[model samples]
Structures are given as C-alpha cells and as structure tokens.
Target: MNTSPPTAIVRGATVRFGDVQALDGIDLALTRGALTVVTGPNGAGKSTLLEVIAGTTPLTRGTVDRDGAVAFVPQRTALTPRLPLTASDMVAVGTWRRAGLWRRLSERMRGDIAEAMERLAVLDLAHRPFAALSGGQQQRVLIAQGLVGRADLLLLDEPTTAVDARSAELILDAVAAETARGATVACVSHDPRLIDTAAVVVPLDGGRIDQSIRDAGRGRPRCPA
Candidate 1:
C-alpha cells in the first residue's frame, strides 16, 4: 500500500449549468505518482471533472482539497495566426505559473522548457510558429507546456486524439514519465493504450460516476464512487 497522502481529493462534487448537470456527486482521490484516466462518451462530464480538479470550474456543491502546483492542458487551444508565437513561446507559458508574467526566465527555467520540448519530440519545432504547426505538432507542443513546470498535478484532456502514432507514443511516454517522477496525472482519453496502463480508471456518465477501477497491478485500492 502506498501510504502517501493523495495529491487531490474531491468529495461530493457537483456542477450544474442552468438545466444541465455536468457532474454529480463525484468523489475521487488522485494518488501521487499515479496516472488516473477518465473515460466516457461525449457529454460524459469527463472534461468537467478535470476542470473541477484544476480549480477552474466551480462546483454547485461539495469541496476539493489539493496540494502543490497544478498544470492543466485542455484538448484544444485557440492560438491566433496573427500572434506570431513560436512553439518555444507556447511551451514557455508553463513557466509563467511560477515565474510570473514580467520576470525574465532564469537559465534553469529555459533548460527545463527545452527538456520538456525534447521529451515531447518537439525541440525541432521550437522556432516554428505555433499556429503553423500541424495538429500533432501543436498537441505535442501544448503537452510540453504542461510538463515544463513539473507540476504536482498534471491534467490533460484527450491528449492523443487525432495525432499520428509517433506523436501519440511520445505523448503517452511523456505522461508516464511524469507519473514516474512522482506527479499526480489525471488525463481524459479514449485511447485504449492509456486506459490499459492507467493506475485508476474513472468512468463518468450522465454527470455521475459509474465506478472507479484501480488496476490490480498498479497504485492503491479502488476509490469509492
């Protein structure tokens, strides 16, 4: 049994937008150094669950308690072609959480950014315009942004979707490496490869949890739904 405290805990979480309920009574705990995959059909509230954990979405009821820094990478980002931001610039956004907007990045921060891009196999794309990159390249760059901070809690939505096999492999390996380095990783993905390797699998439907499955070979026991 891994006795370390959970990185984050969501208790009795619920979210409602007018007549639509996005999440209902979700109770979950994200284990340190473990990967938890959230899977479900469209409108299953999977993304909403991540938002709640990221503290970007407010709950209609219940509470969330979390520790350390959090990095959230959404499924899609809108970057204007007119902005002229390079791939390296996009990855550098991850450092802003700790470095703030105005402070110049230290040498170590720059190194970390470079390391993250390399891990995602996007180091070569660093000088290219972010908006000009292909879908796979853009996704890889965005994930590198999430990794540059070495956040305690890393949240990603559908990271491998619509990407080439090589890109998908790089993304999966990078995510796995984060957990290996003791980050709590929760990702929303339909990829069977991710699901098979996840420490915990969370299935949500109609704004409620169907169940929580902890792989017999990974992490701790199953969390109560």
Candidate 2:
C-alpha cells in the first residue's frame, strides 16, 4: 500500500451559510502524489470541500492541516473585454507568488510559465487577448496559470466543463503529469474520463463524503483516518 503521509487532512469539517449547510462533518486525507477526483451532484459541496483545502474558505467548524504551497484553478473566470490582458500575461500571474509585484521574473520563472502554457496547448495563444479566446481556450489558459506555479498541491474545479474534447484531453494529461511529478492533485469533476483514471475517487452527497474508493487493485490504499 502507499503508506506515505497524507499531503492534507480535513477533520470534522462543517460549513454553514446561514440556514444552508454546505458541508456536514467531513473527514478526508489526500494522498501525496496521487490524483483524487471528487464527484457529486450539483450543490453536493464538492467545490466547498476544495475551497476548504485551499484555505480560501473558512470552515464553520473543524480543522484542516496541509503541506506545501497550493495552486487553485477555479472553474470559471470572468474578464471584461476592456481588460486588455493577453493570454501570456494571465499565465504569468502564477509566477507572482514567488516573483511578487515589481520584481522581474528570473529566467527559470519565465521558462516555467512558458512550459506551463505549452503543456496546456495555449502557447500559440500567448499574444491573443484573453477575452478574445473561446471558452475552452480560456479554460486551458487558466489551468496553465495554475501549473506555472509548480505548487505542491494542485486543486481544480470542473476543469473539463464546457471544454472541447481535445482541450479536455490536454487538461487531463497535464494534471496527470503533475501527479507523476509527485504533486498532489485534487479535481472536482463529473467527467467519467477523469474518475476512471483517478487513484482515488471520492463521492459526495448532501454535503458529506459517501465513500472513498482507492484503486486497491493498483496497490493504493484508502484515505487515511
């Protein structure tokens, strides 16, 4: 079994938005260097779970312990046509965490950004206005932005939604590569293509984890307690 320590752990996690409970006590451990796919119906708290792990949303109750830097690629981003930002410019934002504002990007950082864009197949769209790109193209660019950081933990929400078949394939390939490189990846998706390949599949319902299926046949163990 893959007995390595978990990359992140969430215990007794509960999130309430007024009268609505987004998550009911959830205990989860994300295995390091594995692809974890969170699947559920709409409003099943898939995105909320990811947000909790990303530390962007505070839990109403519970605790989360995580390791290393994180890179989150949200499902959708709205950019006005007037923004005048190019695709490359959007991807370069990933480097800001390390390079910071007003600091020139080092050669390695620049190369990382370029490599990320190329892996997502958006390198050719580098000079195009971000707002001018198609939905699939924009999605790929956002993913590239996330990848450029080379964060230890990568989280994505519905990355393949509304994307073309080729784009979806490319996105999946890129995330899989991240896992191969020992980065922990958690993706919220309904796409069977992703679930079928995930080392761990987590299904949620009514804001609770229904089950965690680790591909034991492949020698992967269940989420740690």
Candidate 3:
C-alpha cells in the first residue's frame, strides 16, 4: 500500500440550494487507500457533496481540502454522442489538465490512455464508439476515464445507477481494488448494501449525517437507533 495519510478532508461542511439545505455539518476524513461509501436515502445530499469536493459548487460552509488532484464520475455519464470518439479517446481527456491547452499528447500520454483502459477492463472497448455502448458499458467506460488520471482522490456519484447486479458488483469490486492500491474513494449510493465494503459508512438523513456505527458482516452497517 501507499501508506500515505489522507489526501482529502471534508470538515464541518454544509451546503444550501435555495430553500433546501443540501448538506448540514458533515465532517469526513478520507485517508489514502480507504474506500468510504456515503449511503443514504434520496435527497440526502450525496451528489452535492461530490460537487463541493470537485470544486464545481462552492461550499456554503466548512472546508474540503484535496491534497492532490481529484477525479469525479458524475451520476450521469458525461459521454458526448455523435462525436465519433472512442472509449480510449474519452479516457485520454482525463489527462488534459496535465498538458497545456494547445499541447498534443506525447507517447507517454498515449501509453497512459491504454493502461487506464486495460486497468478498468475496457481495453476491448477502446476502439468502440462510446455512444454506442449500453448503460452499464458506458458506466464502466466513464469509470475507466476517471481512473486515467491515477488521482489521489476519486469521487463517484451513484456509480451503479442503471446497472445490473453483475455490472454493479464489478464496479464496486474494482473500486475496492483501487482502495487496496492506496487511492481514497468517496462514493455515494442509496443502497445500504454498498456500505458493506466501506471502511467507513456515513448515513445521512434530513441533510444531516445520522449517528451510525460500522458493522461490515451484517449487510446492515448502520447502528440500530
């Protein structure tokens, strides 16, 4: 394992959307190589947390400090249709921030693209048109793209949405594998079972995280109130 300390911190965080308080007083610590799953019912501020961490939305309160680059996979796959781009091309976009705006990819960049695709089991899809894939396939491709950066932190919002159990398991297993490799993963899911693999399970209700305890084997990680 990397043995590095936490690379991301979400402390006393809160967010408001007009009349709705998306998040309320949330404190979270994501250490390197830990997979933390945030589980809650609908309207529990899952996506909001991811957005705040990714810097797409401003924090209404508190702080989220990411020590290194963070990769985010939104609930909706950000695949562009009719663009004639392959899955490999989409993954390559993840490296864009590392290069100057006008700079082209070097041989090393291309190698990274291939490696990321292979890592996520999407190498066979590398030449396939991204838009032509099914929902599950697209989800996997997006995950592959997100991993291309080898980011210190990865935030996924409902990553298993619309996928079958087999596909979902594959995604979750891959996420766990990444954690073992020393990357911090913060994922949100409405499914309680998702928390089974999480080192930390945070349940939120009414915009506040519920006081909960972790019990991995029971399939119910939340404490009985």
Query: In TM-score terms, which candidate is top?
Result: 1
- Tens-digit lDDT track of model 2 for 1-225: 456788899999999999999999999888889888898889999999999999999999999999988898877753454557999999998888889977998899889988999999999999999888999999999999999988989999999999999999999999889999999999999898888778778788899877654454755333444
Query: Each model's TM-score, in the order given?
Result: 0.92, 0.91, 0.85
lDDT at 208, model 3: 77
Tens-place lDDT per residue, model 1, 38-149, is: 9888999999999999999999999999999999998865345455799999999999988999999999999999999999999999999988899899999999999998
Q: Which regions in candidate 1 have their CA more than 4 angstroms from the true location?
A: 77-83, 212-225
Q: Which ten residues in a row have the lowest lDDT in candidate 3?
A: 216-225
The top-ranked prediction according to lDDT is: 1
Model 3, which residues run further than 4 Å from truth? 1-4, 77-84, 191-193, 212-225
Query: Which lDDT value does model 2 have at 23?
Result: 99
Better of 2 and 3 by lDDT: 2
In the range 1-225, model 3's lDDT, one tens digit per residue, is 234677877887899989889999877777688777777777888778778888888988999888988898887545355557888877877887776456898899888888777766788988898888778877887887788778888888888888877668778777877787778888888655556667667777877778753464656334212
Error of 2 at 56 (Å): 0.9
Q: Judged by lDDT against the true structure, how good is candidate 3?
A: 0.77
Q: What is the C-alpha lDDT of each candidate?
A: 0.89, 0.87, 0.77
Error of 2 at 77 (Å): 4.9
